[model samples]
Target: MSHSEQTIEREIVSKGLTAPRLTPTSIDEAIKDEHYWVAPGRRLTVCALTLRNGFIVTGESAATSSENFDEDLGRKIARDNAREKIWQLEGYLLRQRLHDA
Candidate 1:
């Protein structure tokens, strides 16, 4: 479901309930920029997310075996890890807004 605050408010109005939730679109919206970096040996990858407010969050992935390291997979894993952090942060913001409302 769309997770914009407006959308959630509408849902609550119609449903007569309150439950703050986060959605993919909300996460995507809060992210102002995204970047990735690989370590010198290419066995580790880090993903950085720049939020709309200019704060940065990062997550990383490391390969236990050099032979199994893949740049594409590492980027995906690292990005996912970073996105998870975004979820937590966004969730907190959502809950705070709901509480204040």
Candidate 2:
């Protein structure tokens, strides 16, 4: 993967998130959703949250931009990505709950 992608992968891992396997198909699948696109095609990102009370709260995005990067812009994008991830996880949990119910 590229430098930026590698950096993102490291950040995600450092944050204690899930790390998806590093493969073209895996990366493609993960990146299909904005929330899962934490790294480039070769870096794996993982979920870092624990389920509770039938609700799923996302831990955090593993990817972080450079220190010199624009903080405001990065924060905006991170917020959007985090929102998408939380919604995705919530949908999964809801489906599971419905099945269990």
> Which candidate's lDDT is highest?
1
Question: Compared with the true structure, what per-residue lDDT tens digits does model 2 show for residues 16-86?
Answer: 88633343223333332333323443223433332333333333333343434443444444544444554
lDDT of 1 by residue, 36-88 (tens): 99998879999998999999989899999788999999998888788778878
Estimated TM-score per prediction?
0.77, 0.33
Looking at candidate 2, the ten consecutive residues that score lowest on lDDT are 23-32
Q: Model 1: which residue pairs collide?
A: none
| Top candidate (TM-score) | 1
Q: How many residue pairs in model 1 have overlapping backbones?
A: 0
| Per-candidate total of colliding backbone pairs | 0, 7
Q: Which residue pairs show backbone clashes in model 2? A: 12-62, 17-46, 18-45, 18-46, 18-47, 19-45, 19-46
